[model samples]
Target: MSDANWKVAAERDLMSLGGRPRLFESGSGSYVTDDAGREHLDFLGGIAVNSLGHAHPVFVSAVAEQAAKLAHVSNLFASQPQLDLAARLKRLAGTGEDGRVFLANAGSEANETALKLARLHGNPRGKTAILSLAGAFHGRSIGALSITPKAAYQDPFAPLLPDTRTIEPTLDALEHAFAADDVAAIFIEPIQGEAGVRELPDGFLARARELTRRHDALLILDEVQTGSGRTGEWFAFQLPGMLPDGELPDAVTFAKAVGAGFPLGGLITFGRASDLFAPGMHNSTFGGNPLASHVADRVLAHVEDEGLLANVTRRGAQLREAVSALPGVSGTRGAGLLIGIALERPIAADVVAHALDGGLIVNAPAPDTIRIAPAFTVGDPEIEDFIRRFGDALNAASQSSETTA
Candidate 1:
């Protein structure tokens, strides 16, 4: 609220890399303003959370109106919004008749709920192992962290969930792991987020689904960063699978875009697995509350009405092509707006800082990979602006790299 408060945040309460973060006061469509009154074009879209961008009239009204009416109601009595949101998500998640939904607060919480469901579904049998892909980033919590591939985060918190295993995400590797008898679930992100937006080899998901089925393991798709039209498709796996089985993942874990920046996560389950959890098996007091549910409902409705899926397809390719043609940029990988640019020079951090300095907000998750996850509402003008500025920043970074080398 105050600069003093922002200054205090830098000193205490912030975790590592947490201090000195942007002190923003407000945001509008594809833009945010700092406490200092500096406005920056929001290309990052809160790391793929603000699908409609900050303070969209619809989103603002939804939050404001919902806040005024009923903010939160526990899971005891039925809330229409909660049920409606669940029904919408269940349908979207491909859960059809046997579908069930579980709500949580964030990506990690959602994945944790999925893990519990897997364990519960495998109740009659002993299935503990969760096979995760390499270079994965599920979330910050222990359960999700256990399956994540980044050792830098995991090494500090030694003794994560045992029976957790990692594989190369190759067909043979996945088959080998699924050959085991005790695997409860195989968790994967359709597009690995913190792992630099790496897409799994084509058909990997379909293959994993089949392998999991054969081994009685659940195929969990962690679409926290990949869902809600980020990948142009309703879900990334919808693209006809190149995998042997060509099937859908059994469970879908969604978070980032579910509530359109309101912090909602849900798990969609299919098959008889939906019956695994009974009364008190699992619950979240704040989960499926009225406010979040309303927002979730509106977000989905808005996505469809606004034709964001088609826009994501068009603009994502434009952004990718523009970045690829820029000097010092080698290539781009990823589907839709969830793109990662591979810079010829390892100046991604410098480019990010420069882009921010140039009134653009983008981030680099690795030394050479710059991620561009703009809001789905990003228009033609903003996309062009981002490319022009981003290319300039990349040029500047390249020049600096040349000087340094």
Candidate 2:
């Protein structure tokens, strides 16, 4: 579609993420074109979904060829592409046994499926409560939303799904949750995304694994934002340097860049715990469809063939070091592509807008923090350019605020 056609978007629907009146026309590598044909060095990578950057020949061909061949086949049927993608995911996860995959359209639905699995797993043991970490975000559906933190997002939809609880302040909350009689699952992000890239405590994931085992509760890792090589490895939890013990979660939910700009999400589980749900228990109409899974296969294959994992490791460290060295940047958080730069104050939103004007695209996941999850394929030049442009944005933010005062 042409960029001039975007004005019609406002007239058609008022959905979110449209604040910028500017429209994007096309992209190549890590750069994008606005309606006016101004080029932008994109650093956000569509908020971590565009793993390979724009117009990667591999992704374009994968989607186009699959679309021309077969786009949709109901869940009742199986397609070769879908099966192959599932096998690849299982292999990446190192699930030696037949670890089943439940494909869906997006990350939220992915979490919903995992939540349902947990419920079914606990049904036999009479477990009902779902425990989630404070500042955690799973999804928006009542089922996924029930476990998500941030009352601002949840309060409006008060009286959400029942048997859900959030914990913060201390292990007391988690302990109380674990001790509860009706506990079923513990859903948590290995590294919190919207909550300032807040990482899970050291030895805590291992502890949660132990606690869930003790209570016979299922532990679901909401890796939607952290999985699929985003964190310099196949999964953040499995990243050797990130965690002290190098722990692994029972079940993992993935979406975002796993499909590399394709709309696909998946739920993976290990051991007998994954076999909780039987046929007819849960299904997605578009689940395991050809187009999405085919692109997913290509995304994984490209990541491996191009050795993007190692690239992410090197680039992520370089980016973090640069961010930490910035004037007002206080600290850097998150592993690999999922990075958050903490500012001294709430200048993140201002910096984001300024960055847009300075030919760089970034996002403010929190008021005082700027999040950067650029494409793993983004090279050294783009990384250096990003830091240079970002420094101007930060300086502009500081200067503008001073003038307003």
Scored by TM-score, the top model is: 1
- Model 1 per-residue lDDT tens digits across residues 1-405: 687886786677766665465788898889889988998898888888988889888888889988999988788766878888899887776667788888778889999888787777565688788788998888889988888878789999989977888999787887788776788888888888777788888667877777777888788888999987899887777754533433566788888876778989888887766777889878888998999999988998899888999999999998987778888888988898899999886889999888887888888888999998888888888988888888778877788788989
Q: Tell me the tens digit of each residue's lDDT in model 2 across 208-262.
A: 7778878888878888999999998898778764344534566889999888888
> Model 2 TM-score?
0.95
Q: Any runs in candidate 1 off by more than 4 Å, and if so which?
A: 1-5, 13-17, 242-246
Give the range of the ten consecutive residues with the poorest summed lDDT in model 1: 239-248
Model 1 TM-score on a 0 to 1 scale: 0.95
- Clash counts per candidate, in order, are 2, 1
Query: Least lDDT summed over 10 consecutive residues: which range in candidate 2?
Result: 240-249
Among all candidates shown, the one with the greatest lDDT: 2
